[model samples]
Target: MFTTIHRWGNSQAVRLPKGILETASLRENDRVEITAEYDRIIIRKATKKHLTIEERFEGYNGDYRCKEADTGGPVGNEEW
Candidate 1:
């Protein structure tokens, strides 16, 4: 398919058809990495790095203390 590049808010944008997006397994608002190689423009889905629990909290002082909150008696049939 042929598409024309148009000016969009000071940026050049090209509209990708739904078929192309579906084939690429991409959805609206999905992040993509665009690169220019020679005379070709490559568009690929961005990969996200999943961090582990320890990696998420690398720097922690552990100075936090939990305090019980006084929530008024339950209004429903719940065991305390």
Candidate 2:
């Protein structure tokens, strides 16, 4: 899709087409995650973050591999 950047209050904003907005299911005031990867920029829905380990494993099942010594422990030290 193509769009021209227009002024929005103080910062400039791009007008997204209805199709694009629908496809992304974005609504006004909704949060969208933005990040730069390699030569491209990516935008997607923002995910909820769990602060405590218990919060992170709230609904986890065998879908995760926990340390044998620590059943509630994360499989790896990687960030969720």
Candidate 3:
């Protein structure tokens, strides 16, 4: 089947039919890759790797410290 191409804002677009999207296993926010070979264009889903929080932070150790409170009286006309 063929679909009409239309101008969207400053770009060209073609609305994908629901059946086509479903058959391609594509969903909302899914990443896709498009490539052109000679006179034909091909679009496919992008391969992505999902990592857990722990997997993302598998690194060396680091140190962090909090500042100590100053108990001195106000030295300026700043609001308390």
Indicate the residue-level lDDT of 26 in model 2: 86
List the candidates ranked by lDDT, beginning with the highest.
Answer: 1, 3, 2
Which lDDT values do the candidates have, in the order given?
Answer: 0.92, 0.76, 0.84
Instruction: Write the residue-wise lDDT of candidate 2 on 1-80 in tens digits.
Output: 66687989999877767788788898777778888899977878778653698877778775756665745745777557
Off by over 4 Å in 2: 49-80
In order of appearance, the predictions have TM-scores of 0.62, 0.48, 0.58
Better TM-score candidate (1, 3): 1
> Which residue pairs of candidate 3 clash?
none
Candidate that would win on TM-score: 1
lDDT of 3: 0.84
lDDT of 3 by residue, 7-45 (tens): 999998888998999999998778788899999778789
Instruction: Give model 2's TM-score versus the native structure.
Output: 0.48
Model 1 ranges off by over 4 Å: 49-80
Clashes of each: 0, 0, 0
Residue-by-residue lDDT tens digits, candidate 1, 1-80: 99999999989999999999999999999888899999999999989656799988888778889999998888778767
Model 3 misplaced regions, further than 4 Å:
49-80
